[model samples]
Target: MSLLEVKNLKKYFATQKAVDDISLSIDKGNIFGLLGPNGAGKTTLIRMITGIFYPDSGEIFFDGKKFDPVNDVGLIGYMPEERGLYKKMKIGEQTLYLAQLKGMSRKDATAKVKDWFVRFGMESWWNKKVEDLSKGMSQKLQFVTTVLHNPKLIILDEPFSGLDPVNSNLIKDEIFRLAANGSTIIFSTHRMEQVEEICNRIALVNKGQKILDGTIKQVKQDFKENLYSIGADSLPDTTGNEPYEVIGKKEQNFIVRIKPNDKPNDVLQYLLQQGVSISSFNEILPSLNDIFIKLVEGTETARQFQNIKN
Candidate 1:
């Protein structure tokens, strides 16, 4: 089931259409990646979803009902790219306060905060102020506060910023745990490799519009170059009538693209008939980073400012 749905959502600023007619559905228990380059309106779309900004046009549905920003806000946990913690406040107190704002009672919030602090090995820093912690430590604290209320939908933008590998893995594990237990996560970041590893479904937005949407595997297949890697000691010279064209070589593997109207079996058969000793064969799919660049390349590196008419 879809936990959140945005239908033809549009949000405009005086000089830019921040989000323009974008639509997407995020299913329950999905780690969905919302990917885009700078000025791509990802932030604007997320703001609308989290009730921080109201769409100028179109509808948003939360759990199948029309989104009520006032009441539904509590059901979402948003950790923006910019940290929102109070510099002067004690970590423990600030966490409890934020939890209460999400509708949790004081007693429950205290217990929950303790549990998370202990889980993240942050028990000692509770009395410390946010200003005193390093960037990575502060990031861990912010993540805890975001999910303290056990919200059904969680939005994390650049959640891994500034963390070392160990801490990054720590938070990554928590994100997976949250999704496994039924939280739907909207993960926005510029790290394509991380997106490929963490997200099952993704939507790519550029210029305030959604340009691609599908499961990671589906998107890869859609953009595959029909190239295959063949593990062989030596390749037979192409006689110009071969079913595949040798594109390149990597170490012991020969990279080839199957000719149109030719199947993998046809290539294999042709190779075998030539007495080529094949060890392994596998198709090579384009990486998300490759696809992302292929789709967004040639576009202006920076979005130009535009005039909007009322």
Candidate 2:
């Protein structure tokens, strides 16, 4: 049920390859995370998908047909990292105008605006001008406009850029609501925790190439390094003698980077045999950030460390 598919996508600017042979798909109703640090070619790929730029060598498919820039363009709602809105216009007036531009009828647009205004508790401010709104408030106004058209596909870049925790959570909830109601979202953000929370599928890109892409769980498992985190009341004194190598030790816990060939339970038994009381024993899986750096540095580092026998 992929709503969007990209194949061998390539984009070159001058002498640089911004997107090289990238291939990925976005399933229906998925919140796919497009992640990369600055200058990683994430924006290049997004621009092509949104029709802002043409791919040098590739094809895009939307809804089982070859993508037609004009028709399928209306089916997508894109919120660029840089917010786009008329600063001098009233919130209610501007929101309705944008919705209408997206093909929403006047009456339906107004009704939906009212519903969102009440939900966001911004009914009182709707009559006010966008220029008078704070940065966070302006973001909400722009966000409302982006989703007002009820497009089947939504691409949000840095959607939570200017909001406080409360507002960030509010927008996050609405994003989940949209997906639940049959919208597919391509969410791009630098916040690993946010991706972990909301994104089902993810693609990590670096240096104009797709370094990795998969389900969140699958990606994490792929970057696995058999490590253990243990909290103990009395840690064994292995100053000179123990099979386990402690990577680090904190207040009440020690982070052990285990040999991949060693079983986790075997490490636990060795600790217990040394009369150490284990309070908590947990595996150390790679975080999205960790995985990103590993991939960009070259996936070979992960391979070398994946099967070490101690």
Q: Compare the candidates by lDDT and give the number of the best one.
A: 1
Candidate 1 achieves a global lDDT of 0.95
lDDT of 2 by residue, 190-214 (tens): 8999999999999988767887899
Scored by Cα lDDT, where does model 2 land?
0.85
Candidate 1 per-residue lDDT, tens place, 1-310, comes to: 9999999999999999999999999999999999998999999999999999999999999999999999998999999987768999999999999999999999999999999999999999988999999989999999999999999999999999899999999999999999999999999999999999999999999999999999999999999989999999999876899999999999999999998899999999998999999999999999999999999999899999999986
Q: Model 2 shows how many backbone clashes? A: 0
TM-score of every model versus the real structure: 0.98, 0.90
What TM-score does prediction 2 earn? Answer: 0.90
Candidate 2 ranges beyond 4 A from true positions: 237-243, 297-310
